[model samples]
Target: MSKKISYEFLEGIQLPITVKKDILEINKESERLLFINKIFQIF
Candidate 1:
């Protein structure tokens, strides 16, 4: 369930863009990392 949501943000990462560029990719990667950290913290 959570993984599905994480993947949603990771998708379309290859599209050319004049947006935040690498920042957006880093943000998505960070989100996944934070989710992992939280899951680990629970144990």
Candidate 2:
């Protein structure tokens, strides 16, 4: 289902050695996605 796809897509990523700002942005976005996933599981 959609949930499994999202989970795997996130899991499949490999972090790059990059600028601090870029890393922070990616972390924030992933955290938001994780929060949304938790909400989906709750309902």
TM-score of each: 0.38, 0.37
Colliding residue pairs in candidate 2: none
What does the lDDT come to for candidate 2? 0.48
What is each predicted model's overall lDDT from 0 to 1? 0.50, 0.48
Q: Model 1: what TM-score?
A: 0.38
The residue ranges of model 1 lying beyond 4 angstroms of the native Cα positions read 1-27
Candidate 2 residue 11 C-alpha distance from true site, Å: 24
lDDT of 2 by residue, 1-43 (tens): 2344444544565534342234334445556466546645986
Which regions of candidate 2 are displaced past 4 Å?
1-27
Best by TM-score: 1
User: Model 2: which ten-residue window has the lowest total lDDT?
Assistant: 15-24
Per-prediction tally of clashes: 0, 0
What shift in Å separates residue 17 of candidate 1 from its native position after superposition? Answer: 31
